[model samples]
Target: MATVTKPEGTIATTRKAEAEGDQLVTMRGIDWQGYLTILDMKTDRRFPRVVFLDGEVSFMSPSPTHEFLNDRLRSFLRAVLSGLGIPFLPLGSTTFRREERRGGVEGGQTYYLVNRGHVRDKKRIDLSVDPPPDLAVEIVVTHPADDTLEVYRRLRVPEVWVCTETELVFLVLDRNGHYARTDSSVALPGISAAEIHSWITRGGYDDEGAWDHDLRRWIAEVLSPRLRETTR
Candidate 1:
């Protein structure tokens, strides 16, 4: 269930469930300046990830399970990319925003793959002049009332991987600038969403090191040859 409140003349909605353990709060009528102020205040503490779409802002506090899933997925991605000999730059939970587009979001785990070299040497990313990450990940334990996909669309991110408790979904930005569900990852060629989901489920209860070793083994013995053939 969700609770709606009016604070300081702004309409705010908060959602919390004991089973989910994730909390989401949404506030309406927040101007760009207000959003920036809130972001600045929370700069030191990265929890309660923030997103702004138009005049509405959402703050999400992820749970232990959510973060565990996020960490495992990130490790899996890194292992796959390293096994494939792909050069990638990992930028974890960086805030991406553009005022002109009136949208912004803090990614859970983002990576620059094909466009790795574009912002490789930069200390910071200015969306005004920089290309958005090639791959962005989102772990959604609780359904967001805000339109997060719209913010990603405005940022022109090439690909997004959304993970829920049950499944992982791959969304690729198409020619028409809309995200379409895809069977395989555009950023990491030959990787399928269903395969990734299976790996996550398999590794969920195992020892971390042992699970990772098995994942690497699969990549080396099974995925590596397939990728090599595609390149050739």
Candidate 2:
């Protein structure tokens, strides 16, 4: 979630054991761990990824796995994005973990606290109380989405998306809580954010469905066209 999430010029303070600075502010808010147990759902494999404010939860599953793969494909993406100028944050956790998980950790449904989310309306709501992850992308290995999607609605996020490794995608939460079959990225243009995501799927690779620079090329090329079209 912290792919340098904060803009460079925002804050220069640091959090450390024996370090002190003018911007140093101890977290005095919600019981993060206590609220970890909130993601409750009926799934044979229910893994609750606790949503937290620190970079800790993001460094783990869902976020971690996505980060790891993003890292794996970054080199290819960086060149393409740089050439095409596609800017974006890798994205972070969800709200359902806080309201549903109930401390049960499994299924890789990890959650990271977002900094801002859309509780209602187009306004960006920031709960200065709990750490908030702007958005959380959950991967469903296998399961239905009725209740799972509802969890996002309750949290009031501007957007929520779930990708099934490859096949189905649910972008159920819009800025105002409008669910839809097709979804676009807050950073990229297009009705379907498929170009970039292709790199995350099996199609993102060499002949054997393995990931390689080849898939990266396809992403760069495809994104280049999309960006040019949208930027124009």
Q: Among these predicted structures, which one has the highest TM-score? A: 1
Give a tens-digit lDDT track for model 1, residues 1-232: 2223233666555444445667777778777777888887785667888898877788888898888889889999999988888899999989999999999998888999877788998988998888999999988886552377889899999899999889999999999999999888888868778889888767455579989889999999999998889879
Output the TM-score of candidate 1: 0.89
Q: List candidate 2 stretches off by more than 4 Å.
A: 1-132, 145-148, 170-178, 191-198, 203-212
- Clashes found in each candidate (C-alpha, N, C closer than 3 A): 0, 18
**Where does candidate 1 have its weakest 10-residue lDDT segment?**
1-10
The regions of model 1 sitting more than 4 angstroms off are 1-19, 203-206
- How far does residue 19 in candidate 1 sit from its true spot (Å)? 5.9
Measured against the true structure, the TM-scores of the candidates, in listed sequence, are 0.89, 0.45
Question: What is the alpha-carbon lDDT of model 1 when measured against the actual structure?
Answer: 0.84
Error in Å for residue 10 of model 2: 46
lDDT per residue (tens digit) for residues 1-232 in model 2: 1122332344423332232211112222223332232223213222233333322221122334444443433443344545555443333222334424321112222223233232323233234344333444545443334444554455544445565545435354555666665656542235364545565554434443346556556656775676568768
Each prediction's whole-model lDDT (CA) = 0.84, 0.40
Candidate 2 overall Cα lDDT vs. reference?
0.40
